[model samples]
Target: MAKIKTIIDGIEVEVERDSWAIDVARELGIDIPTLCYHPALGPYGACRLCVVEVTKSKWTWLATACDLPIREELSIKTNTPEVIRSRKMAMELIMARAPRAESLFPLAEKLGVTKPRFKCRDDIGNCILCGLCVRMCDQIIGVSAINFANRGHKRIVTTPLHKKADKCIGCNVCVEVCPTGHVKTLDDGSFRHMQTWDADLEMLHCLICDKPYIPAKQFKVISDKLEGIELKRICPVCRRKETVDNLRYAVVEKVS
Candidate 1:
């Protein structure tokens, strides 16, 4: 396997070649903060919170750790004063755009953002414009229902023509990954609702326990892939318990 010798915080560490700074940092037990970079998705450097200082051959500059590729003899400083200042600025900027993002408060405090200095644009709403939802819909699920629309401060993520997209499979992956609560999956125990895209999918109850487990659309997607193999309509817990009970009964019958 290809490898690269990198120096991080004055310690020599070896990591896989072509790996990003986040991957190398993680391998060295370092936790680099990230917002738009999900393990299941490609690196999108929309959030500049992971900025880090890198020096190679007397040249030094800051780069986003999530997208910065690992190179041979690369030296990185994740907690330098300059890096801290840049990260704090990025946090404040994101906070300004997403003041109602309760999920960001912890990170904001960690990055030394007491209060955002930028003016709040209520017209922009609470989204940080990270594009995680759009990327997930396009890359993972193969459904490009939503995308970044407009330009600059006018930019927003929404379905085409700002209407409910019919191609959406009702997967809540977008809502699940959104660090800011901008995307919503509202459920009142009967239906799984994607509020932004206006997808109201009926939730399916478990056959064994009759508790709502999955959305009908999501289930249909999975079942369609499986073809003739009919999946059991039981939640994970009930499935395990039923399997154990059936096994016990079979063992008793064999012994008899």
Candidate 2:
């Protein structure tokens, strides 16, 4: 490991090169607040909450600690007046767009931000579009079911072609990874559906038989009776033959 020297809160600290500034700070017992920085996923630096002033040789600028790599002879200032102001502003902006939950209130108080300064959007509640959920689903889980669509203020997360997503495995990994409870999973009698800021699942019907095969998760409660049954896009006649054949083969193997 290469030696990395950096200044945090005017104190010199040495770290391993290629380590993130956030990890370095944590080692030094300095807390840098962040929202989208997950250890399991790549840092997008979208939240802008962990910005810190860094001076490396001649170049000096604000960089995100979550994304910045420590180098030799790097100086980092994490708790200056300017840094505190910027952090407070970022927290206020995020709070304005987030739900008024009890968890956020104490954090706001700790950051010295009493109230939000900007106008709150009507659609703003839980999600800040930090891309943590999307990155985890795409990079970690290898399921590209959800992504950002549109642009700027009109931007929203959606499935491909803005159509009902057929690739979602109902794994609920997205929900578990989200920092805010923006994505919710509800169980209907036929299947489990997820609700997020941008989209909802549509009721599914069998194309060949025109039977109501799946209801929206928010509409009905799933019962334990239908737990192991797989709901595929097939009619009862096709499913009966497949199930019977599998059972027959299992019985023959047991006897043999």
Off by over 4 Å in 1: 246-256
Tens-place lDDT digits, model 2, residues 87-201: 8888888777774644567767888988788876658557777888788778876667889888987776677887766666555777887666777777564456675523445
Alpha-carbon TM-score of each model against the true structure: 0.91, 0.71
Q: Cα RMSD for candidate 2? A: 9.6
Number of the top-ranking candidate, with TM-score as the measure: 1
Residue 67 shift from truth in candidate 1, angstroms: 1.0
Once fitted onto the true fold, the runs of candidate 2 whose alpha carbons sit more than 4 angstroms away are 57-60, 99-102, 188-190, 197-256
lDDT of each: 0.87, 0.73
lDDT of 1 by residue, 102-177 (tens): 8889989999997899996676667999999999999888778899999998899989988876677778889888
| Cα displacement (Å) at residue 46, model 2 | 1.0
Clashes of each: 0, 0
Pairs in steric clash, model 2:
none
Q: Measured by TM-score, how close is model 2 to the native structure? A: 0.71
lDDT minimum window of 10 residues, candidate 1? 119-128
